[model samples]
Target: MSAQPPTPPHMTVDEFLVWASERPGRHELINGEVVSQSAERAAHWKVKLAVHVALLNAVRAGGLNCHVVPDGATVRIDDATAYEPNALVYCGEEAAPSALTVDNPVIIVEVLSPSTGRMDRARKLADYFRLPSLAHYLIVDSNEPLVIHHRRQEGCDILTRIIREGATLLDPPGLEVVVAEIYGAS
Candidate 1:
């Protein structure tokens, strides 16, 4: 008897949303498969919270038409993929408090954990840059006082900077926060 061909388990974006909502924890759709995000450590949480607060403060202080959101809100990368960044900044008239997903994010932040470090730095980085509205992608290291900032330049070019002790400036959205502020007593 010939073995039957294995059925594909891939899911579309709509199907992923339905499938993921029934599950208990945070999930992402990558390559048409559901991926559960790792539970963060206390240090990780601290950094994440700090980053959110800093960005929020910046937006408030500058009176910019931008909003900072935590991980619960998803960003649709394509028909087969979506991600919930640790924190994100969305601009323009489309940002609403009631929205569950954001399609245009100006800034995306991720707190690096050992479990997801490689993926965050590699695959996720590539996926996020695909969004035209994305200007900066910050990877904060919880283990050290460091942040890797990837700033999008004109016409497909990108500028990268590593911040250890000084502040990193995020233009287009107009925000500046020191690297130490992100670790914030964690």
Candidate 2:
């Protein structure tokens, strides 16, 4: 008898979720491949935590029906196209493809990195704009104390990052953030 070739492994979101649920790490699905996403570096993680806490406080104070998403939560564009944005804010629960395939998120943030900078600025920007609910995209530099926010407008061209607070961080419309609060600590 002739031996057959090895069978390729395949898993659905549900299956992957079950298997990954037992593990103590973050991961994502991109183009049918289960790619393991890495944790942020110590400095980056510190900044991320600080920003998340600030945003959470602001979001809560506003009494808005929104939730701050943790990093590594998958956002599916299509069956084959998915991305785990660094941070995302959704007005209502966007957690179900059982109900909705696309999430109309208002904001998407990606902490800039050396490797992902070009991809985030170019490819990800175009991909993210496909969402009508997307009002702002914040590209934050990990090495520098800067944030470049791209906000959409009704008639005129979208507002680019005009808020250069130097060490002061500024949060514009749709979201409220204290400049000094985030950057002042470290």
Candidate 3:
């Protein structure tokens, strides 16, 4: 196999954003460092598309203020931080003027691939919690058709629920995915 070109050592969020926007691979900024994701394999795309399809349908049907984005947006958290979660629900009013950084989002979903599973399940979950409006952080595993998450509880944050492949609940907009969908055609 040919050697992949070397990526720059690091980049400021703005520089990284500009650079990523100009190119094609999946990339996200964390603490002033630019991290590029591997080109997803077929299985990876399957799970991502499955969940996004569910979310998109529900959000649109509900007529909710939130917007559904596929490969959504890269939000600038601060000069030193920016991230683009795979699928995010940006709820609430988008007033006449809004800032680049969305301090709140009702939900954020990170579908895991072999290369990114660890960070997405831990480091990334922690960051998502920092958003006050983040009520649900869904970690959809490609290997297992499961929606694991830290769901907000009755007045508190808790990892209280596991929406397995067979279950369905209406957080809002009312869409459901059978865990089997995540496992693909196995």
Question: Model 2, poorest ten-residue lDDT window?
Answer: 164-173
**TM agreement with the true structure for every prediction:** 0.90, 0.71, 0.77
Collision count for each candidate, in order:
0, 1, 1
**Against the hidden true structure, what lDDT does model 3 obtain?**
0.69
- Model 2, range 1-186, lDDT digits (tens) per residue? 666333226556554555455566765554555666565686677656666776777778777777777575656654544567777777775465343223676777787776667877987777677667778777777665677778777853567774445332223334576644555544
How many clashing pairs does model 3 include?
Answer: 1
TM-score for candidate 2, please give it: 0.71
Worst window of 10 by summed lDDT in candidate 3: 95-104
Ranking by lDDT: 1, 3, 2
Error of 3 at 172 (Å): 6.1
Of candidates 2 and 1, the better by TM-score: 1
Query: Could you tell me the lDDT of residue 159 within candidate 3?
Result: 60
Clashing residue pairs in candidate 3 are 165-179
Which number leads on TM-score? 1
Q: Per-residue lDDT of 1-186 in model 3, one digit per residue for the tens?
A: 667556567778767766776666778888867787788887777888887777776676667777655564765556766777777777767623423345566777888888888998778777777666677778887766678867766665566467665645547434454565555444
Angstrom error of the Cα, residue 17, model 2: value is 6.4
Candidate 1 or 2, higher lDDT? Answer: 1
Which parts of model 3 have CA positions greater than 4 angstroms off?
1-10, 93-103, 154-156, 168-186
Ranking by TM-score: 1, 3, 2
